[model samples]
Target: MIRTSAAALAFLVAALPATAGERMNLGIGTIFDNDAMGDGDDRWRSGSFAISHFRGPEWRGKLPEAPGSFIEWRFRSEIITPENVSGTAITSDRRYVGVLSAGLHTHFQRNGAEVSLGADIVAIGPQTGLDDFQDAVHDLIGTSEPRSAVNQIGNDIVPTVTLEVGRELALAGNGHVRFRPFVEAQAGIETLVRIGGDFTFGGTGMGAFRMRDVVTGQRIDGVIGTADTGLSFLVGGDIAYVADSFYLPSRLGFDLTETRNRLRAGLQYDGEIASVFYGVTWLGEEFEAQPESQVVGTIAINLNF
Candidate 1:
């Protein structure tokens, strides 16, 4: 996975302990849509990775202000070559799927509102040399859906767990403009419940909650050595209502038909060393022999030294 995320970003810049208001960054991304530019069987091609950690405010009197404690890491890939999903693939899915994640947050202040608490972990599978080159392209085009190979499920290791809560609004008071709203729930093997919101203009305040910049603003006001070179932009969106999604196609077994609203929209740019984002997703209609309706396109870039 890119040499294990470049050796975990050089071991977190060598055992994390550099503080002039520490806040590091690195990101990358891409995604495709239109059923992967039209080749059917719903396709996808994605690549992403990110790493960010912040703990500024000069450790707030030895760590206590909690303005959203942070730690993050991510990786993703959903490539299905042949230049975009096709070329005689005998069903039951999984050509290339990979995901790895880690997220954590913590912010404080109750009665006066400004709360946050979070957790995350996700790991999907498939990537053994692209599943052995897609089993040699399905053994050189040799099978025809043995009922989807006796109903799929086995890209190995699927894990999930998430929990969330957030609220941080700063409408207008020199903090520029801000709003962060959230609600979340998740479970192993894949289950869900989600609610979201985001709106930011300027810097600071974006305590991660799906409207993703993958969380920034020094990871929600942890405050780094005063510097953001000004200029900023953001707009966020989300809407999800999924019941289960164990890699679709009727939980990988077939018998299609499973979709319960999922949408997203985004645009962002945070400067002072590059940060950019663009997202778009719409999915609803996952089967019944594939009834269309699915779109995705995500883009990201971040670099801050």
Candidate 2:
């Protein structure tokens, strides 16, 4: 599957045309938390790199008067290494995520602002390395424990549909500085099947434990089943300084539920041919018991034809 996905991405990138007025962007960055510490469990070190392309109507006089539309596809991958693990032991995991979105954008001339409404389809796959953590827990805590059957704690493909609403405000100097803020909400069902050995412990000789969907309040049978729906919300803003031929973009944002806070600063040089951007990000992850953080730097090359 991984190979197939990689091949597909490569094919898509290669098939894209370099045409006038087309926009393409590629970025690579790491997320690190200076305070994240622990032997083997460096909670603060994880990152993802992505490439995106947007094609839309050109702007006139600082903002486009007519409404425009675009479709964007993003691919990202990240890895997380746990702390306090043993020698040559792999206690971390990796994730591959993809998002496809299409939206309509309108620039309000009177306000010097722009608004975008879009929908996104998201998919995530996790790759775990190491003994099933859930299995270890069951051996120690007993199968009857409420948490014993949560097998394969990390690996799964979660598909979701989300809605996004964002706006950009023009700041001082007509275009020298700008603030872009946006929010996204997502809700969908999560299906769990093919239980990992870690999720279940010895239980009344019943083989493995099972769980019902918390959202739909329905009993789930078979290895794979769908649960009730859940929602996630994100809010953030970017402050950018724009020049005739250069720009700088800074961002601060947070997400609810999962509790993610991020700060990013980067420099961008927009020339007649293409643009190059480099930046770093500080991200915090509020996981149970022990929260993790990371700091990462990124570089991106964009072509605006």
Candidate 3:
């Protein structure tokens, strides 16, 4: 996968046009989240690849071009390894998932300043290993019990809207630096199937294992019923150091989530034709019972036309 991305970057750089009007920066990057630490089990080895494209009007000789409009599209995927059965020490296999998204960005400027507003649509592809997990849970819970747990893992289509407001800071050098601190809230619904019909086993002597549908599959709904909402806040800055030949750029950002916090920093060498970046990510908090923190490495290449 890494090699293919590199080749694509080279093709894009070589194909860019010489005329200069509205310039666009297209990037391809990968992010790997290794074995989650807090979660004692090593069932999930997750990674994501993003193909991003951003474009805006030129500002060279123009009056710094107040603020133009831009758009971006991103596609990401994640995979999880199988988990160990509750009572049995046997570990389940692995699973894979893919998500695709496209967003629109609009930048508005007044007095030497810029603010951006963006929205996106996200779609989830088919997932694997969910049925096996459900079956395993059912076998553990037995049919004679009154309550059973159902695992609802399937494909979904979601539309999310985001609003971002940010400003640009003029640097002493020839180039300018832009800082954007934004808050994004996303909410959606999907269908879900419960394995074992809401039953607890072994510890509390609850009797009768019944697998009942809280929500029927016949209902015109996607698996894993919607109603899933996530809120994220990010503060970051992008610096562009313009030189006679090219621009040296860097970005640093921090993201806070309900389960984990992430710190990301990367540097990009932007030439007239293409750009490349190397980044490191540190994950804080234990997903399970482990003591050590998780770390991830990333690389990206961008081509402009």
Worst 10 residues of 3 by lDDT: 213-222
Estimate TM-scores for all models. 0.28, 0.44, 0.45
Candidate whose lDDT is highest? 1
lDDT of 3: 0.31
Clashing residue pair totals per candidate (backbone < 3 A): 2, 24, 35
Tens digits of lDDT, candidate 3, 94-187? 2223344444434445464334334444444334333344345457977221111122124554544333333323232322232223222222
The digit string of per-residue lDDT tens for model 2 on 38-87 reads 12222323233344444433422232333332223433333333332222
Clashing residue pairs for model 1: 257-287, 257-288
Give the Cα lDDT of each candidate. Answer: 0.43, 0.29, 0.31
Reference-based TM-score, model 3: 0.45
> Which scores higher on TM-score, 1 or 2?
2
Model 2 vs. true fold: TM:
0.44
Superposed Cα deviation of residue 42, candidate 2 (Å): 6.5
